[model samples]
Each structure stands twice: as structure tokens, then as C-alpha cells.
Target: MNPTHDWSTTPVTTNLVRGAADLEQTPHGVLPHRLPAWARAQNTDGQLAMVESQPSGVRLAFRTGATTVELDVLPTKRDYVGAPPRPDGVYELLVDGRPARRATATGGNTLTIDMLAGTAETTPGPADTLRFEGLPDRVKDIEIWLPHNETTELGALRTDAPVEPVPGPGRKVWLHHGSSISHGSDAAGPTTTWPALAASRGGVDLVNLGLGGSALLDPFTARTMRDTPADLISVKLGINIVNSDLMRLRAFTPAVHGFLDTIREGHPTAPLLVVSSILCPIHEDTPGPCAPDFSEVSSGRILFRAMGDPAERAAGKLTLNVIREELARIVIQRAARDPHLFYLDGRELYGEADFAKLPLPDQLHPDAAAHHRIGERFAELAFGPGGPLAP
Candidate 1:
């Protein structure tokens, strides 16, 4: 706290939060989660719990006359055993719908992860400060978007002037779910994820459920989306399942059906888009359980390779191609009865043409530029005029 400053502290509350579906009160502060308590209760996986709590699309919005604002947050940062150091999460500020400034908070808990061993350890630490100064001296709507990949416990908000929750802009909410790529993997920052970008370009509120390594068409996730209020919905499927070798083609179709079934229970009339997997050349025809190719780790490079035998495709093992075909077929069949349902070939967002120009740097997730490209394309295809999700 600055001795020269007089600030009013606001308690972290749901009324000030945008883009998150739920908030959990913690000992130090309130932690936002993309999934609600009931949905979280259904899944006991530590990974799922961690990713959902990362607050991928969450932000704080308020109106204030203060020229200076500060936020105190305890961030749970991740560390990898053999990989390069992960970049610090970015906190972006928007004033009156335009980017104002960005800041990064240091001094928080650390979670060390060993990818090969599938182990993790956490060390607690103290909260850090994020301060923004010298804003225009006028009442204005301001938003602070939290880091999409880091789990943050918001401690307090302080502004030199009194602040109040910004009234909802009344934009249609778009709830989305997918794998890491959709979860902002390799994207520049929290607000730069493809979904975030698409939401911005489309002028829609977002509830991103792009759980990294956890988007396996889980029924519980579907139920979460079903219960959340949204005018539009999309579910990107395939990569995680294929890479994990979690199921064969025989099980994939039924799982997709069941996932959609759960969502339709609550949102039968909402426009639901079923999207396939983006192009990953390594997994195009080859099957997966993708494994890390850490041979270049010494050079500060991390890559992945499909470990599943391609020959297993004959045994009904799933691949990107197989999943795409199955998804298209399923959507067509279901659309006959459910006219609100639509199918989007994931390749339409990132396909052969995209790879020729901007490739997936790690044989998997897109780089930051690719994230922008995908976000632009999605906005055009899904939210553009005459598109399936268009108003």
C-alpha cells in the first residue's frame, strides 16, 4: 500500500466478474472457475479441477473515475521438468472497450509438473500486486482480463475513486468447450486465445471451457454447459481423445451423442455447433497416444510425436481424419431431427491451406499468430452473416 495514496478496496464478488460461470471463495480471496460447483463435484480428476480453475475467459469489469487501479492476486504458476520455462500469465486492461495496458504479477505459488512421470507438486507463496496508473481522469468502464492459463485467486481491488460493477453490456453469451488449443495453448495471453479473440470480434460474451488435455466429450462437462446460460454454444472435439488413445471409433460416436444429449436437455433450442479437430499433420492419418519428443529439450525445444501404431487404425483406433468423418456424419444425421444443431469441420478453421503458410510449431498447438488467424476465421464462419450461429 502506498502511503501517499488513498484507496477504496472492493471485495471480490460475482457482480464484478464477467466471462466466468462460477466463483469459489478461498481463504485468501475469491477464485473464479469456468465450471460451477455442481459440475466440479462430478469430476474428481485433479487435472480437470486445476484447468477449470485457471479462469481462461474470466475478467473483472467495473466503472470508476480513478486514474489508478491495483489488483492483488495469488497466482498458481506452472513449471515443467524438462521443457522451457513457461511465460508468465498476462493481465490485460481495457478502458471503454479498448486495450489500455498489460501487466504481469509475480510472487505466487508454484506448481512443478513432470510430464513424463505425470506428477505434480505445489509450493505456496504470497500474493503479488498488479498496478495500472495514469488512466484518463473520467468515469469509464474498465475491464481486467485474468491470465487464461494460470489459476488466480483474486485478493482485492483498489481504486483511488469509488468503483461500481459495470452493468452488463447485454451481449449474447457464447459458451465454448475444447482441448488445449481452445484453452489458449501457445496463444499470446489470456485475452488472446482464439475463443477470446472470436468473442471480441463477434461482440459476444464468452464462457470458455477449453480444458487442456481434458476435453474428452465428458458428459459432466456437457451438463455444465447445459446448465450455464448461453445464447450460443460450440464443442470442439477429437485431439485430446486421439492423443490419449482414450477410446476407439466404436466408443467415440456414442460418447459424442451422449455429450450432446446432456446439453440438449437444457438448451434444446440454442444454436449448438459441433466442431471437429484442427489439422495436426502428425495425427492426420496416424493414431495417437502422442508422446513428447524431448530429444530437442537440450536445445530448449519441446516437440510431440504420435506413439500409437498407425496399423491400429485397422483395429478401429481413432485418428483426426476418422473423428472428423464420424463427426460430420453424426451431425448430419442428428440435424434432421434437431434443426438448431450444426456441424463445423474443424479444418475449416485450420486446415491444409493453413499449415502451408502458418504451421503448428510443436506438432500440436498453434502459435500466437495462428491463434489470431483461427479466431478471425471462426468469427467469420460461425458468427458472420448467414452463419449457423448468427443472430
Candidate 2:
């Protein structure tokens, strides 16, 4: 598919993932828009089926002259009825910021860009993993873009470093969990997710558990994070839960404790950071997706695009402020005993001032530039020298 050439001049290195990288953005049961714009975009309606699974894209070009690079571009978010109905064309395989080749995305979320020596379209067998056979030494970095789906969770990094004891119990694995914002929504590509970008800068490894709508104090998810191996851990909570109105105040507090408790089981002494939701005026106080008449709608529907009025929140809903205050209270109580425990407000990463400078498109997710800003803050606060994530 030929991508729509929008030479309107954009940033060269955009944050592929919106806020965090550990978060996985799965379409799940969302409707696929065969709606017109779907034609111009790649994976306009694609999803990764399993939890914490690896999805691969095409490699654009490969060279061995002290460098080898591979990447494929796809669109993570799409609008059909409102925006133009043109499908996002095809995925463009780029090498060092240049369009080197093109990839036809198939299987909804599968597109391969191969540039090993000569050119070949390496396709996934769908039965096994999508592998990039041979990579040259000094590959420096791997960058990805999107015309297809951009919600990518890297399963493994096939390196020649041989499993030789990964050095000092590994580079202090940083485990993070959050919403789709953390799941690389509306970002550029996989490796460029905020978590991945921040990790690269901090020089650490990451295990992300960012689920779209499921981060709302789900025991199963917390169990998954608890069971997963890690050296350090963090949870960016509140936004999705409040927006979705998953649980009540009484339920949320214990759930938060339970979630942290579960994680502590595995990473007993690891540096654990608890992050509250960022600026979201709409559901910052509202507890749920309800009706205009102040009662629960029989329909289990959510107006993600709707702005939660002050009245709505006053009616007894969960807001970011409410969650953050509670989270702070929890962290203070926990930190008194657990020295490794820490709390960082998400807004400290992106606050009201930043909002004025760079407004969010839909008042929820920040754009690529904002992702970079947020990542920088996270890196400085959480992973910089003398920071909590440092060795």
C-alpha cells in the first residue's frame, strides 16, 4: 500500500508511543473501520490477540558497514466517520529517516520490512514468531514508524550477546503499568514509545504491562505484574479507571493496596514508584460513564470523547484529583515502612503548564512532541543519576 505522502514537514524522530511503552494497545472488541480512511492507513483496525505478546513489522533496509537498521511504519489510531475515509495506504519501511521501501501489512497487525544484504519481503508464518533472521554488528538502534498499527510490545531482542549472565542481575528491569497512553497510542512506532525512549536514555530494560481499559485495579493484571520478573517496578494509575468508572472509592483503595501487595510478592525490595493520572479535566472527578440524567445507563456504553462536566463529577464520580489525592495518601502510608516505595504524580511529568504549551488533541492523549517531553521528565525523575531507578 502506498502511504499518503504528507511532506508537510514533521518531526524526524517522533515518539511512536504516546506516554509509556509497557502498555499494550489492543483493539480487542473494537469495530474495524472499513470506513474509507482505512484505505490510506495500515492496520487501521488491527490488534495483538494475546496479553504481553510480541507483534513484528517489516524491515526497511539492512547494511553491515558498521551499521544495520530496520523499521516499519503504521498508524495506531484512526477516525472514519469524521476524518477522511481514505485508508492509511501501506506501511513505509524507513532507514535512517529515509523511505527505503514499502510493506503490505497483512493479518491486521503483521507487516515485515526486510533489508538483509539484498531485498526480500520476509513474511511471518503466523504459527511461530516474526523473526528478522540476520542483523549486522553495530546496529546502533532500531527505529519504527506507522501507517499500520503502532501498538507494539517487543517480546524479545534477538542479540548476539549470548545469555551470558546478563551482568549484575540485568540492567535493573523497570516494570511499568498504565493505560493506552502508556500503550503507545497515536505515536509513531514501536521502539519510539515513551517507555522505550525513556529506557534508552536511562540505560535500563523494561517490562511494560500497559493495558488499554484493563488497568482499573484488576487483580488478574496485578497478578500478572507480580508474577513477571523485574528489578524495579512502577504503576501509573487512575485515568483509565476513572474514565471507565471501573470501581468505586471504597473499592479503589483496597484494590490499589492489593495491586501493590501482589507486585511486592515478586519484587520484594525493588524500587517501586506509584504514579497518579495526568491532567484529564473530563473524568478528573467523575466516577463513571453515566447518563445525562444523573443515573446509570442500562447500556454499558462509554463516551470516551465526552467531557465530564463539573456537575457530573460532583455527582460522585472518580476524578484524577480524587485518585491522585488518594494515591498520595496511600504512598505516604506505605513509604513510611517500605523504603523502596515512592510516589510520583503523573502530572509532574505533564502538568497544566505543559498543557497550555501543547494541548492534547482530544483532551486525553498528548501528541508526539508531548510524549518526548513526558519521557524526558520520567527519565530525569525516575532514572537519572541519583534517581530511584539508578544502579
Candidate 3:
């Protein structure tokens, strides 16, 4: 928008992207995908489709001397039917690996999702530009972390000076998969997601596969992990399986084994960590099939509650406690043959004490502060000098 500045346009290509498995070219621009196309094609679940494209850990990395940078994006924002309109997703700019500035695109597409009716509708809109000015005039490593919760299509990227792709930092790559919490639910920004924060503290690169509501022990997801190259791997399981009531304990153990089996095929020697769900009081002892507590919908707030009876655990129904026990047992058994495999009680990351102080605001996902706590704990437990993932 400033005629005085000499702007140069740069194509948004794969070399400039990090933390995404694929870049899809769209009529408007390129869309980042957490899951590759083949894996996405294997499932048609609308929730999976939506979250995988949210770009939780995805970012555009480059080096430039530009004092001004601008990006055009067509962001598809999600709106719940009766709940309040979600705030605009944020774009965070980092200079030399530090938080620098933030911006948000206005007037883009909207995807209205009716949770009660189990339907979603998309409304098209024009692209919006996000501009950041007054950056340091000297050349620096710049990273534009995409919104963690919005489906964004990249358009033109403009800078006052020429830009080139930045090389990877050559840090250990940590590949992680889990549920909505891991997908950055309720986290303030992409770079602040627990995984991202942990990676930063641990001095590692991150490839986060945290699909909201879709971290069921799916074979395709396991296969995707098996094929991807990583120096470290982790799978956080249980919350989504229990909340969706997708399976009973009779099937969960074997599914988990098979999932690990697949991942070991490719990353046989990587430090593999199997983590159970963090403590959710509602599901800690009770079986789920969690349902939204719509009683407060009139106030534009929604909470979730477990729908299954406590007595049903007798029938091998799964709960957070039960899953934790199983995961620990499985990891111990597997560790005998695979010393690189390890298990972390998710509670170690976010447990009862932490919950007492910073409760999950929605009774499901951690807030930004809790995310910071969890990330710090994870870095200490998993990446510290004596930790399993220690280099």
C-alpha cells in the first residue's frame, strides 16, 4: 500500500514452509496440510478434514532485509451455529526466533459448523492482506507462523526487499500426534502451542500432527507417521477415543500396538514416547462419550461433560485412568525389546495440581497459560539432559 517502498513479490512454495506435510495449490493460493494428500483421501470425516488444514505448527520461513512485509491470505474461519463468533485468527511474525509482531486478516471466508446438527457450511469471501512494517532494516531470519485454528490459503507475499527461503536449523525433528489439545485448542497462537513451545525449549524442530477430535488410533495416521522421517516420535492417545466413544478397551490396546508397529517400521530407532491423556476430571474416572454442556449456550459459552456411566468401566469401557494404565503397561512391555521406546504419564505434563491452578476453561482444552505450563514440563521431562529424548 505504500508507493514509496519498492516491493518484490515472492511465490509461496514448499521450501518456504515448515511443519506441514503438504502444500496444496488452490485457485486463490496454496493451502498447508498437516496430513499428506493420500492420507487425507483415505478418510472423509469432516472434522479431520477441517483440523488438518488448520496449520497449527506451519509457518513460512525466509531471510530478508525488508523493513516491511505483507501477505495476502484467504482464511476460512470457523463459526459454531449458536455460539459466539470466533475471534479472527492471528498471524504471528518472528524475527531471529523471537516473537516480534502480530496481525490478523479481516474479511475472509467463513465456515459455519453446527455441532448439534453435525453439519458444516462454507461461505466464500475475498482475501485480506496482513502487513507488518518497521522491521529491522538488517537481514534476519523471519518466520510468519500461520494461525493454529484457521484454514488459511496463502496468496501473494510481498516484501520491501528481496527474500529467500531459510534453511532448516538442523535441529532434531520431533514428530508428534494427538487430539485437539495437541492441535492447539484454545492456545493463544501457533508458536505458543504446547508442542511448539516444548520444541523451542528443547532446541528441536516440530512436526505436529495434532488433529482436533481426530486422534483416534487410525491406521492411516499411523502409516503416515511410519513414512515420515523424524529423529523423535510421540503419540498422545486416549482423550479423543474416549470422548468420541469410538472404541472400547477391548480394541484400544491392539490398535495402539499396531499403530506403534507401523511407526517402528520407519523410525525403528527413534526415541518413541507414548503418552496418555492429561487429567480431565470429567473423564478421569468416568467413561466417555463426552457431550457438550449446552446449558450455558445462552451465555455464548460451551462446556463438555462425559456422557457414559461410571459403572460401565466394569464392562471394559475406557476412561482416562484406564487408558493411562494400559499405555504404561504397553510401553513397558515394548521397551523390553525396544529400549528407545518410552512412556510418559500425560499427567506429568498437566496434572491435578496444575489443573487446580489453571483449569481447562472449556472443561476440555487447556488455555494459553496451561499450554505454557505443559510445554515447560514436557521439555524438562522429555528433552532434558537425563530425559529419554535427550540427544
Using lDDT as the measure, which candidate wins?
3
lDDT of 3 at 232: 89
Residue-level lDDT tens digits of model 1 in 270-345: 9999999989999989999998899999989889999988899999999999999999999999999999999999
Decreasing lDDT order of the candidates: 3, 1, 2
Candidate with maximal TM-score: 3
Cα-based TM-score, every candidate? 0.97, 0.63, 0.97
Task: Give the TM-score comparing model 3 with the true structure, all chains together.
Answer: 0.97
Q: Least lDDT summed over 10 consecutive residues: which range in candidate 1?
A: 1-10
Query: Model 3: residues >4 Å from true position, as ranges?
Result: 1-6
lDDT of 3 by residue, 94-149 (tens): 99999999999898889998989989999998899999998987889999999999
lDDT of each: 0.91, 0.53, 0.92
Candidate 1: residue 297 Cα off by (Å): 0.4
Give the lDDT of residue 380 in candidate 3.
Answer: 93
Tens-place lDDT per residue, model 2, 1-391, is 1122111212111122222223333333111111112211322212222212222121212222222222222223222222222233244433443444443333334333221222223233221122232333433333333332332322222223221111132366677787767765545554455775677678776555665444667665666677666777889998777766666677888989998999888888989999887786556555555222212223431124444565655445677888899999999999888999999988888888998998776567777788788878889999988777764
